[model samples]
Each structure stands twice: as C-alpha cells, then as structure tokens.
Target: MARSSTNQNVHSADDSSLDAGGARALRRGLQLLDALLDAGPEGLRVVELCRACALERATVHRLLATLQASGYVATAGRFRYVPGPRLGRAAAAPGQPNMAVRLQPVLARVSAAFGDAAFAIVRDGPHSHCIAREVGTHPVQVLVIQVGTRQPLGVGAAGLALLSALPDAQVQQIVAANAPHLAAYGGMTAERLHLLVRATRERGWSVIGNHATRNVLAVGMAVRDARGEPVAAISLASTLARMPRERQQLVARTMREALAPLAV
Candidate 1:
C-alpha cells in the first residue's frame, strides 16, 4: 500500500513538471522545427519560418538560438537556417528511398511509352532545373538537357508548361518581368505568352514547336502534389519530321494517362 502511494506521488510530480515546461513559446519552437525538417536542404528565412509556423520574431529567435546551440540547426547570413549535420545524419540513417528515387521507375515507364525524351523538372526562382530525365530510343535527339541543367522559365517546353500551370496573375507577372528574354523566341511576347497559357489550360497540356531545336517538337504536362499545386513537369520531345500529328496526340495522351494516378 505504501509503495503504491509513493508511485502515485512520483507520477503526479512528473506530470506537473511537464505541464510547467509546456509553454506556448516552446510549442511554437517545435512547430518551427517541423517546418525546417520538411523543407530539406532548401532552408527558410526567419520571416518565412515565423509565418509558416505562426510564431513571433522574438520567440523564433530565442528558439533558434537554443536549437543552434544544441547543434540541431545551423544559421547562415542574416536569414537562412538549415538542418545541421546531426539532423541530416538522422534523416539519412533510415536508408529509406526518397521521392526522386521512387520516381525513377515512373519516368522510365513514361519514356518507354512515348518513345521520346522525358524530363522531370522542379521550379527554382526564374529558372527550372531538370531533376531527372530518361533519354528516348531515337537515333538523333536533342541531347542538351541533362540532369541538373537549368533553363529559363519561359524558354523551353518544360518551362512554358509549368508557367502555364500557374495562376494567370502570376504568369502575367513572370512574363512581363521577362519580356526582354521573350523577344529572343519569336512570338513569345507577353500577350502571346498569355494566349499560350490560356490554350495550355484549355488543352490540359502544353506544346512548343521547334523553339529550342529546329525540327524538334515538345509536349508536356505539369504534375501536381496532394495540395493540387504543381510539384514538377514531365515532357516528351521528338523530331517533328518523325512524329506525325496522330503520334503527337498519342504521346500527349499517354503521358497524361501515365501521370493520372500520381496526380493529386
């Protein structure tokens, strides 16, 4: 009976300690940590972190200081904070496959079905970077784009496809700001770009006619995540001389079908 009473008293004391330590600021700090973990290598700024986690600047700063001192985070410059080596080690220890790694098989299937080069690209500011690509089984193909290559957001089929997926106001802003570069690609004027975006939205895909290479045609569609926001774009490029109108439509349809199950 005495031992049972002692154990109950200890449990009560532990609960009280936990309740005392669970302040609002501490809860906010944990939220910020979760956001950082989700962001991966692309760190967040103080303002963005605070906005995303709904914490005040002062509270976040204090939390960051504590986390940094404990070696969980590393801050650079005046704004950016990324997970430190300890966090990265923990993340990599499980040896679980990442999204890009799992996506390789799907990309291969798309390339096999279309018989044209297929690319998966993610947006990075004014440019989009090719994260993965599967080369087609063609004798002569556009071999310039490789993994990690960055292209202007309005230059190639992949870029235009992604741009078209964005909201009209956002597309217009990007096009207007990039007007000078648009002139290089004939008929890529802001008005023309807007028209193309409208057409892409209507068609549920985008196509560019020999803009990058003389006789190459490209068709692409944006892939969205669970939030209905575009995470990346997949595209197929082939020589216009080889791919007839029917074949082009088939390729577009096949690509869309392949991506349908993965769509949000």
Candidate 2:
C-alpha cells in the first residue's frame, strides 16, 4: 500500500510537470502571435521570430508549423512568417472590442473638453507606446504623437507620468539603466529626474514644454490598475502659443478632474 501510494504521488508530479510544460508552450505560441501582430505585413524571419519570442529555432519552427496548420499564420519565401488571411479576417470581424475601442469614448470626451490632441499610451519595456489618439478639431493643432509610435520612458510627459507611478526602487533602476538616453534630453540628471518624479507622484500628473517637438507642450496623468500600479497614461498636446500659462493651468485642471475616475 505504501509503495502504491508513492507511485501515485510520482505519477501526479509527472503529470503536473507535463501540464506546466504545455502551458509554457501555449504562452510561447501567443508570444509568437504578438510578434507577428506587431511586425504587421512585413512579417519576420525565423531568426528574428526566435529572438523576439525568446524561443529556440526548432521550437519556433515547430510552433510556426502548428500555427500555419491552424490557419492563423503563414510563411513566405521559406524564411518569413506573417499572419494569415484568417487572422486578418478575425481582426476585421464585427462585435469584438479591443482596448482602443474601450478607451475611445473617454479620449473623445477629453479631447472635446481640452480642445487639444489627446492620447492613450501603454508602457512597452523601456519605451512608452501610443496606442490610441484623437486629434483636436482646432486648425492649429499639435500632432507629434501618432498611434504605435514609441517614446523613451524618461523624456516626455506620458513617459514621466508612467515612470512616476512605479515603485521607488524600480524607478531608480530603470532611470539608471537609461541614463545615457536621458542625458541627451538635458533635463534627465539624477537630481532633476528624481525631483520631477516626486512632484509627479505628489500631483498625480506630469507636464512638459517642447521636449519632443518644437512649439508643442503636453500634460499627462497616469492611469492605475486595480492594485494601484500604473498601467497606462493619457496626455494632451497642444501648440505652446495657444497654451499660454492660464490656459495650460485650466487644461491641466480639466484633464486631472476628467481622468480621476480612471485611477485605481
């Protein structure tokens, strides 16, 4: 009876290991899909796919084969893999709402209220990426950021807003690692950066003037998740001439009030 119970325990452990391995494989497959989605029509070579997905060549090849068999991806010229027609069809299908869809109404309202371009951005590793944007109806508008553009995480309002929401230790680590790029921007010295971050944290927003583009100014506030960690940010950008001191303060007040409900 003792031997039988021991064997059963061993079998259960082996099954658990297999299940974990299968989960990891599924996760890798999803990572491959994400890489393809981000690469768009350009697709990716096997080597590039492997590197992006952090998988071995053989593993990526096998997963690609499986994805191809399922009509979710396709290969071209024996080296590149891209999302197949089925995937595109799925993307074009009606009734599915993505993050952009959910955030559109809020962005529209903010843009209408502020009379400036408003954007929603998500952090992507060391960069912050614009996910959605609504341009202001004004004739003279600021149009520096577009959807899918990546910006360094220590320079702009959106980046600073998101960085300010991180834990102190993590923020320090990221700032240290990105010191070189930060230095290029001229206001990224450790002392200045820490001060800005602290102020952002205290006020729950960040503002910048013409750092990324000439004649443009921006203000951003962090959007936190349920656990109160920053998950995203919303920013409004306008021409500096149109956004003089009083107007800037008014816009910032309006934005802060409008975005308060979105915080965790």
Clashes of each: 0, 0
**lDDT, candidate 2, 153-180, per-residue tens:** 7477778898898777556665665666
The residue-by-residue lDDT of candidate 1 on 1-264, one tens digit each, is: 999999999999999888877776578767888988888545688898989988789978889888888767865323567675456446653666543564566678878876667877766544567878888776766654788887556567777788888776456556665667766764457677777778888988888776556677777788777778775787778777767878767877887778777633
Tally clashes: model 2: 0
lDDT accuracy of residue 238 in candidate 2:
86
Off by over 4 Å in 2: 1-97, 186-190, 260-264
Range of the 10 consecutive residues with the lowest summed lDDT in candidate 1: 84-93
- Per-residue lDDT, model 1, residue 168, is 63
- Candidate 1 Cα misplacement greater than 4 A, ranges: 1-99
Candidate number of the best lDDT: 2
